[model samples]
Target: MFNGEISASSLQQISPVSFAYIGDAVYELYIRTNFLLPSKKISDYHHKVVEKVRAESQASYLQNLYPLLTEIELNWVRRGRNSVNKSPRRLPLQTYQQATGLETLLGYLYICDRPRLEYLLSQIKIY
Candidate 1:
């Protein structure tokens, strides 16, 4: 979890760029944890799951899954997606970054001992 508190004033002072930085790692960890299921072969599973966890796939997942998120979670996703100063990659457009942010925020929440992450994952009808 991010212990660094962002006050209202400080929120304005901070940059989306910075959030994205944290968000990227957070998202990847979530994917790695979630996709590393016991049922799948390691190499084949990694190949299959990596596509879903990547920037483009995550963006698509976010779009399809957005309606299920609660208000607070949605806000976090939006903040991450809308953030500026993102590093460009060979993936799709801006949506990938946003997806990364959402994943990262979810990862952060999970690590912070938030029960909502599990709840949210459960509500996601689409795998």
Candidate 2:
């Protein structure tokens, strides 16, 4: 079995915002790659995908879906949510920051080779 451990030292080295940055791309790529068809117009597909992948949308998703998360997952989300340093933004502060943390956790899990990403995606009752 693969020892799916993320080192504390490695986690400490990465900024929460940086994790969110990579995560936003990773999550969107997952959504776009999964939902967009080869036959569809690229522009139209991208527009449709962006609606779901934006920070606000993701934040809403996380809030509604928070109850479904495991204890460990909740901790990860909290770490990202409570991270002190942040980028400047025009969006609502709380939602945007929470969403950033959500994305960061998702990105972390993706890199950690954890099955939680797929599991959480599968459990999502919303589209």
> How many clashing residue pairs appear in each of the predictions shown?
2, 0
With candidate 2 superimposed using the best TM-score fit, by how many Å does residue 77's alpha carbon deviate from the native?
Answer: 1.4
* lDDT by residue (tens digit), candidate 2, 93-117: 7877778877877877776755778
Q: Model 1 segments beyond 4 Å from truth?
A: 1-40, 111-113, 125-127
Question: Highest TM-score, which number?
Answer: 2
Tens digits of per-residue lDDT, candidate 1, 1-127, equal: 4564445776555455555565456555665677666677788767866776666676766777677776766776777666644546775557666666666556545544356666655554335
TM-score of each: 0.61, 0.78
Worst ten-residue run, lDDT, model 2? 118-127
Candidates in order have lDDT scores of 0.61, 0.73
All models, RMSD in angstroms? 4.1, 3.3
Q: Which residue pairs in candidate 1 have backbone atoms (N, alpha carbon, C) closer than 3 angstroms, thus clashing?
A: 27-104, 81-98
